[model samples]
Target: MVIADLFKKTEITVKNIELGEVETLNELTPEQLQLIEKGLQTVGFELLDDKRKQIVQKIKTIIIEIVQNQSKILQKINPSVYIAESIGRDYKYLTTLFSEVEGTTIEQFFIHQKIEKVKELLVYDEYTLSQIADMMYYSSVQHLSMQFKKITGLTPSHFKELKANKRISINQL
Candidate 1:
Protein backbone atom coordinates (compact mmCIF):
# COMPACT_ATOMS: atom_id res chain seq x y z
CA MET A 1 0.00 0.00 0.00
CA VAL A 2 2.98 2.32 -0.37
CA ILE A 3 1.36 3.98 -3.35
CA ALA A 4 -1.97 4.35 -1.61
CA ASP A 5 -0.24 5.78 1.44
CA LEU A 6 1.65 8.24 -0.72
CA PHE A 7 -1.56 9.47 -2.32
CA LYS A 8 -3.32 9.61 1.05
CA LYS A 9 -0.48 11.65 2.49
CA THR A 10 -1.04 14.14 -0.33
CA GLU A 11 -4.78 14.33 0.57
CA ILE A 12 -5.78 12.43 -2.55
CA THR A 13 -8.41 9.74 -2.17
CA VAL A 14 -7.52 6.52 -3.90
CA LYS A 15 -10.77 5.11 -5.24
CA ASN A 16 -9.34 1.99 -6.73
CA ILE A 17 -6.12 0.01 -6.78
CA GLU A 18 -5.44 -2.04 -9.89
CA LEU A 19 -2.10 -3.24 -11.18
CA GLY A 20 -1.20 -0.12 -13.13
CA GLU A 21 -3.91 2.18 -11.93
CA VAL A 22 -4.75 4.22 -8.86
CA GLU A 23 -8.04 5.90 -9.45
CA THR A 24 -8.76 8.96 -7.38
CA LEU A 25 -12.03 10.54 -6.34
CA ASN A 26 -11.04 13.87 -7.83
CA GLU A 27 -8.48 15.29 -10.18
CA LEU A 28 -5.09 16.00 -8.67
CA THR A 29 -3.44 19.38 -9.03
CA PRO A 30 -0.03 19.62 -10.62
CA GLU A 31 1.61 20.17 -7.21
CA GLN A 32 -0.21 17.23 -5.62
CA LEU A 33 0.67 15.00 -8.53
CA GLN A 34 4.30 16.03 -8.29
CA LEU A 35 4.49 15.27 -4.62
CA ILE A 36 2.87 11.88 -5.03
CA GLU A 37 5.08 11.03 -7.98
CA LYS A 38 8.17 11.97 -6.00
CA GLY A 39 7.06 9.80 -3.12
CA LEU A 40 6.54 6.89 -5.48
CA GLN A 41 9.98 7.36 -7.03
CA THR A 42 11.54 7.20 -3.60
CA VAL A 43 10.10 3.73 -3.18
CA GLY A 44 11.17 2.54 -6.67
CA PHE A 45 7.60 2.90 -7.97
CA GLU A 46 6.70 5.15 -10.85
CA LEU A 47 3.62 7.16 -11.62
CA LEU A 48 2.71 5.92 -15.10
CA ASP A 49 0.84 8.94 -16.36
CA ASP A 50 1.45 7.88 -19.93
CA LYS A 51 -1.47 5.89 -21.21
CA ARG A 52 0.67 3.55 -23.31
CA LYS A 53 2.98 2.78 -20.40
CA GLN A 54 0.03 2.16 -18.16
CA ILE A 55 -1.37 -0.37 -20.60
CA VAL A 56 1.97 -2.14 -20.73
CA GLN A 57 2.13 -2.31 -16.97
CA LYS A 58 -1.40 -3.68 -16.86
CA ILE A 59 -0.42 -6.42 -19.28
CA LYS A 60 2.58 -7.32 -17.16
CA THR A 61 0.51 -7.38 -14.01
CA ILE A 62 -2.10 -9.71 -15.48
CA ILE A 63 0.52 -12.17 -16.69
CA ILE A 64 2.28 -12.06 -13.34
CA GLU A 65 -0.91 -12.67 -11.42
CA ILE A 66 -1.83 -15.60 -13.63
CA VAL A 67 1.56 -17.24 -13.47
CA GLN A 68 2.42 -16.48 -9.88
CA ASN A 69 -0.91 -16.44 -8.10
CA GLN A 70 -3.86 -17.74 -10.08
CA SER A 71 -2.51 -20.98 -11.44
CA LYS A 72 -5.94 -22.60 -11.67
CA ILE A 73 -7.41 -19.64 -13.49
CA LEU A 74 -4.45 -19.57 -15.83
CA GLN A 75 -5.03 -23.20 -16.69
CA LYS A 76 -8.62 -22.41 -17.51
CA ILE A 77 -8.06 -19.47 -19.81
CA ASN A 78 -5.83 -18.32 -22.65
CA PRO A 79 -3.64 -15.43 -21.56
CA SER A 80 -4.12 -13.40 -24.75
CA VAL A 81 -7.87 -13.56 -24.44
CA TYR A 82 -7.78 -12.94 -20.73
CA ILE A 83 -5.61 -9.89 -21.13
CA ALA A 84 -7.76 -8.51 -23.91
CA GLU A 85 -10.94 -9.09 -21.94
CA SER A 86 -9.48 -7.67 -18.74
CA ILE A 87 -8.24 -4.46 -20.36
CA GLY A 88 -11.02 -4.05 -22.93
CA ARG A 89 -8.44 -3.72 -25.71
CA ASP A 90 -7.58 -5.69 -28.79
CA TYR A 91 -4.88 -8.29 -28.24
CA LYS A 92 -3.00 -7.28 -31.40
CA TYR A 93 -2.60 -3.69 -30.25
CA LEU A 94 -1.56 -4.76 -26.81
CA THR A 95 0.99 -7.24 -28.18
CA THR A 96 2.45 -4.72 -30.65
CA LEU A 97 2.69 -1.99 -28.04
CA PHE A 98 4.21 -4.33 -25.50
CA SER A 99 6.83 -5.49 -28.00
CA GLU A 100 7.69 -1.93 -29.02
CA VAL A 101 8.12 -0.77 -25.44
CA GLU A 102 9.57 -3.88 -23.76
CA GLY A 103 11.62 -5.38 -26.63
CA THR A 104 10.06 -8.78 -25.99
CA THR A 105 6.87 -10.50 -27.04
CA ILE A 106 4.18 -10.97 -24.41
CA GLU A 107 4.42 -14.73 -24.88
CA GLN A 108 8.14 -14.69 -24.22
CA PHE A 109 7.69 -12.67 -21.07
CA PHE A 110 5.03 -15.08 -19.89
CA ILE A 111 7.33 -18.03 -20.48
CA HIS A 112 10.12 -16.34 -18.53
CA GLN A 113 7.79 -15.72 -15.63
CA LYS A 114 6.60 -19.32 -15.71
CA ILE A 115 10.15 -20.62 -15.74
CA GLU A 116 10.98 -18.39 -12.83
CA LYS A 117 8.07 -19.89 -10.95
CA VAL A 118 9.33 -23.35 -11.81
CA LYS A 119 12.72 -22.40 -10.43
CA GLU A 120 11.11 -21.29 -7.20
CA LEU A 121 9.15 -24.53 -6.87
CA LEU A 122 12.29 -26.49 -7.60
CA VAL A 123 14.18 -24.66 -4.91
CA TYR A 124 11.42 -25.19 -2.41
CA ASP A 125 11.94 -28.96 -2.67
CA GLU A 126 8.39 -29.55 -1.58
CA TYR A 127 7.09 -30.84 -4.91
CA THR A 128 8.18 -33.42 -7.39
CA LEU A 129 8.98 -32.40 -10.95
CA SER A 130 5.74 -33.95 -12.13
CA GLN A 131 3.74 -32.11 -9.53
CA ILE A 132 5.43 -28.86 -10.36
CA ALA A 133 4.71 -29.41 -14.02
CA ASP A 134 1.04 -30.07 -13.29
CA MET A 135 0.82 -27.05 -11.04
CA MET A 136 2.38 -24.87 -13.74
CA TYR A 137 -0.07 -26.12 -16.39
CA TYR A 138 2.45 -28.05 -18.36
CA SER A 139 1.19 -30.93 -20.44
CA SER A 140 3.67 -33.31 -18.87
CA VAL A 141 6.89 -33.39 -16.94
CA GLN A 142 8.87 -33.88 -20.17
CA HIS A 143 7.29 -30.82 -21.69
CA LEU A 144 8.07 -28.81 -18.61
CA SER A 145 11.65 -30.03 -18.60
CA MET A 146 12.12 -29.15 -22.24
CA GLN A 147 10.81 -25.63 -21.84
CA PHE A 148 12.70 -25.10 -18.60
CA LYS A 149 15.92 -26.18 -20.24
CA LYS A 150 15.26 -24.00 -23.26
CA ILE A 151 14.68 -20.90 -21.17
CA THR A 152 17.19 -21.39 -18.36
CA GLY A 153 19.94 -23.32 -20.22
CA LEU A 154 19.72 -25.88 -17.43
CA THR A 155 17.37 -28.68 -16.65
CA PRO A 156 15.07 -28.34 -13.67
CA SER A 157 16.93 -31.14 -11.96
CA HIS A 158 20.22 -29.39 -12.46
CA PHE A 159 18.83 -26.10 -11.26
CA LYS A 160 17.63 -27.69 -8.05
CA GLU A 161 20.92 -29.50 -7.58
CA LEU A 162 22.88 -26.29 -7.92
CA LYS A 163 20.80 -24.73 -5.16
CA ALA A 164 21.90 -21.28 -6.32
CA ASN A 165 19.71 -18.22 -6.01
CA LYS A 166 18.91 -18.25 -9.71
CA ARG A 167 15.35 -17.06 -9.46
CA ILE A 168 14.68 -13.63 -10.89
CA SER A 169 12.48 -11.06 -9.24
CA ILE A 170 9.06 -10.83 -10.91
CA ASN A 171 9.54 -7.11 -11.54
CA GLN A 172 12.75 -7.82 -13.43
CA LEU A 173 11.09 -10.48 -15.56
Candidate 2:
Protein backbone atom coordinates (compact mmCIF):
# COMPACT_ATOMS: atom_id res chain seq x y z
CA MET A 1 0.00 0.00 0.00
CA VAL A 2 2.86 2.37 0.84
CA ILE A 3 4.36 1.46 -2.55
CA ALA A 4 1.11 2.47 -4.21
CA ASP A 5 1.11 5.73 -2.24
CA LEU A 6 4.67 6.44 -3.30
CA PHE A 7 3.77 5.97 -6.95
CA LYS A 8 0.79 8.30 -6.56
CA LYS A 9 3.06 11.31 -5.94
CA THR A 10 4.70 10.80 -9.35
CA GLU A 11 3.62 10.24 -12.96
CA ILE A 12 3.91 6.47 -12.54
CA THR A 13 0.65 4.55 -12.57
CA VAL A 14 0.92 0.86 -11.88
CA LYS A 15 -1.66 -1.43 -13.44
CA ASN A 16 0.41 -4.50 -12.47
CA ILE A 17 4.03 -4.43 -11.31
CA GLU A 18 4.66 -7.54 -9.23
CA LEU A 19 8.19 -8.21 -10.52
CA GLY A 20 10.79 -6.38 -8.45
CA GLU A 21 7.60 -4.88 -6.95
CA VAL A 22 8.21 -1.81 -9.11
CA GLU A 23 10.32 -3.09 -11.98
CA THR A 24 8.50 -1.45 -14.84
CA LEU A 25 6.66 1.76 -14.00
CA ASN A 26 5.04 3.76 -16.80
CA GLU A 27 7.22 6.87 -16.48
CA LEU A 28 8.83 8.94 -13.78
CA THR A 29 11.53 11.59 -13.57
CA PRO A 30 14.84 10.77 -11.92
CA GLU A 31 13.87 13.21 -9.18
CA GLN A 32 10.66 11.35 -8.54
CA LEU A 33 12.45 8.04 -8.39
CA GLN A 34 14.97 9.45 -5.90
CA LEU A 35 12.19 10.88 -3.77
CA ILE A 36 10.34 7.59 -3.78
CA GLU A 37 13.50 5.67 -2.84
CA LYS A 38 14.25 8.02 0.03
CA GLY A 39 10.66 7.86 1.23
CA LEU A 40 10.73 4.06 1.20
CA GLN A 41 14.04 4.00 3.08
CA THR A 42 12.72 6.33 5.76
CA VAL A 43 9.74 4.05 6.24
CA GLY A 44 11.85 0.85 6.57
CA PHE A 45 11.02 -0.35 3.07
CA GLU A 46 13.20 -0.69 -0.01
CA LEU A 47 12.45 -1.05 -3.68
CA LEU A 48 13.13 -4.64 -4.70
CA ASP A 49 14.78 -3.84 -8.00
CA ASP A 50 15.90 -7.32 -8.96
CA LYS A 51 13.71 -9.92 -10.62
CA ARG A 52 15.19 -12.77 -8.55
CA LYS A 53 14.54 -10.86 -5.33
CA GLN A 54 10.98 -10.21 -6.46
CA ILE A 55 10.48 -13.93 -7.02
CA VAL A 56 11.74 -14.64 -3.55
CA GLN A 57 9.30 -12.15 -2.06
CA LYS A 58 6.47 -13.69 -4.04
CA ILE A 59 7.38 -17.15 -2.72
CA LYS A 60 7.49 -15.80 0.83
CA THR A 61 4.06 -14.26 0.38
CA ILE A 62 2.59 -17.57 -0.75
CA ILE A 63 4.15 -19.50 2.12
CA ILE A 64 2.90 -16.92 4.57
CA GLU A 65 -0.56 -17.46 3.19
CA ILE A 66 -0.26 -21.17 3.91
CA VAL A 67 0.92 -20.52 7.46
CA GLN A 68 -1.67 -17.87 8.32
CA ASN A 69 -4.77 -19.10 6.55
CA GLN A 70 -6.57 -22.36 6.07
CA SER A 71 -7.81 -21.16 2.74
CA LYS A 72 -9.73 -23.12 0.11
CA ILE A 73 -6.81 -22.69 -2.26
CA LEU A 74 -4.37 -24.48 0.00
CA GLN A 75 -6.77 -27.38 0.47
CA LYS A 76 -7.66 -27.60 -3.20
CA ILE A 77 -4.17 -27.67 -4.68
CA ASN A 78 -0.61 -28.74 -3.99
CA PRO A 79 1.76 -26.01 -2.78
CA SER A 80 4.17 -26.21 -5.72
CA VAL A 81 1.26 -26.15 -8.14
CA TYR A 82 -0.38 -23.24 -6.32
CA ILE A 83 2.81 -21.20 -6.25
CA ALA A 84 3.70 -21.94 -9.87
CA GLU A 85 0.21 -20.98 -11.00
CA SER A 86 0.10 -17.86 -8.85
CA ILE A 87 3.38 -16.48 -10.22
CA GLY A 88 3.19 -17.93 -13.77
CA ARG A 89 6.51 -19.74 -13.54
CA ASP A 90 7.70 -23.31 -13.32
CA TYR A 91 8.13 -24.59 -9.77
CA LYS A 92 11.69 -25.72 -10.52
CA TYR A 93 12.78 -22.24 -11.54
CA LEU A 94 11.10 -20.73 -8.48
CA THR A 95 12.75 -23.31 -6.22
CA THR A 96 16.19 -22.62 -7.64
CA LEU A 97 15.78 -18.88 -7.29
CA PHE A 98 14.47 -19.22 -3.73
CA SER A 99 17.37 -21.42 -2.67
CA GLU A 100 19.94 -19.16 -4.29
CA VAL A 101 18.54 -16.10 -2.54
CA GLU A 102 17.32 -17.63 0.74
CA GLY A 103 19.88 -20.46 1.18
CA THR A 104 16.97 -22.76 2.08
CA THR A 105 14.48 -24.77 0.13
CA ILE A 106 10.86 -23.72 -0.15
CA GLU A 107 9.75 -26.82 1.73
CA GLN A 108 11.98 -25.89 4.67
CA PHE A 109 10.58 -22.40 4.69
CA PHE A 110 7.04 -23.77 4.61
CA ILE A 111 7.82 -26.07 7.55
CA HIS A 112 9.29 -23.21 9.54
CA GLN A 113 6.19 -21.13 8.84
CA LYS A 114 3.89 -24.02 9.72
CA ILE A 115 5.73 -24.56 13.01
CA GLU A 116 5.38 -20.90 13.85
CA LYS A 117 1.66 -21.16 13.21
CA VAL A 118 1.56 -24.21 15.45
CA LYS A 119 3.15 -22.19 18.22
CA GLU A 120 0.56 -19.44 17.84
CA LEU A 121 -2.27 -21.97 17.85
CA LEU A 122 -0.75 -23.75 20.84
CA VAL A 123 -0.75 -20.52 22.80
CA TYR A 124 -4.42 -20.02 21.96
CA ASP A 125 -5.05 -23.50 23.49
CA GLU A 126 -8.30 -23.88 21.61
CA TYR A 127 -7.23 -27.01 19.77
CA THR A 128 -5.45 -30.22 20.56
CA LEU A 129 -2.33 -31.25 18.67
CA SER A 130 -4.49 -33.62 16.64
CA GLN A 131 -6.78 -30.81 15.61
CA ILE A 132 -3.92 -28.51 14.69
CA ALA A 133 -2.33 -31.26 12.67
CA ASP A 134 -5.58 -31.92 10.87
CA MET A 135 -6.22 -28.27 10.15
CA MET A 136 -2.71 -27.83 8.81
CA TYR A 137 -2.98 -30.85 6.52
CA TYR A 138 -0.34 -32.91 8.24
CA SER A 139 -0.89 -36.56 7.56
CA SER A 140 -0.94 -37.30 11.28
CA VAL A 141 -0.18 -35.69 14.63
CA GLN A 142 3.09 -37.62 14.76
CA HIS A 143 4.24 -36.07 11.49
CA LEU A 144 3.45 -32.57 12.72
CA SER A 145 5.17 -33.17 16.06
CA MET A 146 8.25 -34.52 14.32
CA GLN A 147 8.50 -31.41 12.08
CA PHE A 148 7.77 -29.02 14.97
CA LYS A 149 10.53 -30.55 17.08
CA LYS A 150 12.95 -30.67 14.15
CA ILE A 151 12.49 -26.98 13.50
CA THR A 152 12.15 -25.65 17.09
CA GLY A 153 14.10 -28.30 19.00
CA LEU A 154 11.08 -28.99 21.22
CA THR A 155 7.99 -31.09 21.11
CA PRO A 156 4.61 -29.42 20.70
CA SER A 157 3.44 -30.68 24.09
CA HIS A 158 6.47 -29.26 25.86
CA PHE A 159 6.10 -26.03 23.96
CA LYS A 160 2.51 -25.78 25.14
CA GLU A 161 3.46 -26.32 28.78
CA LEU A 162 5.86 -23.37 28.61
CA LYS A 163 3.08 -20.97 27.56
CA ALA A 164 5.59 -19.08 25.51
CA ASN A 165 6.41 -18.74 21.82
CA LYS A 166 9.67 -19.51 20.08
CA ARG A 167 8.29 -18.46 16.76
CA ILE A 168 9.73 -15.71 14.61
CA SER A 169 7.77 -13.27 12.47
CA ILE A 170 6.99 -14.42 8.93
CA ASN A 171 9.26 -11.77 7.48
CA GLN A 172 12.16 -12.94 9.62
CA LEU A 173 11.74 -16.54 8.56
Backbone clashes (count) for model 2: 0
After superposition, candidate 1 runs with Cα above 4 Å error: 164-173
Candidate 1 vs. true structure, TM-score: 0.88
In angstroms, how far off is 132's CA in candidate 1?
A: 0.8
Could you give candidate 1's per-residue lDDT for residues 1-173 as a string of tens digits? 77777877888888898656788888989998899889989999888898988899999998998988836776678889999999999999999999999999999999999999999888888999999988989889999999999999999999897885566769989
lDDT of 1 at 35: 95
Q: Can you give the TM-score per candidate against the true fold?
A: 0.88, 0.83
> Best by lDDT, which number?
1
lDDT of 2 by residue, 1-173 (tens): 76777777655667764534664445667777788889889878886667888889999998898779965676789999999998999999999999999999999998888888999999988999999998888899999999999998999999897774665558988
Top of the candidates by TM-score: 1
Clashing pairs in 2: none
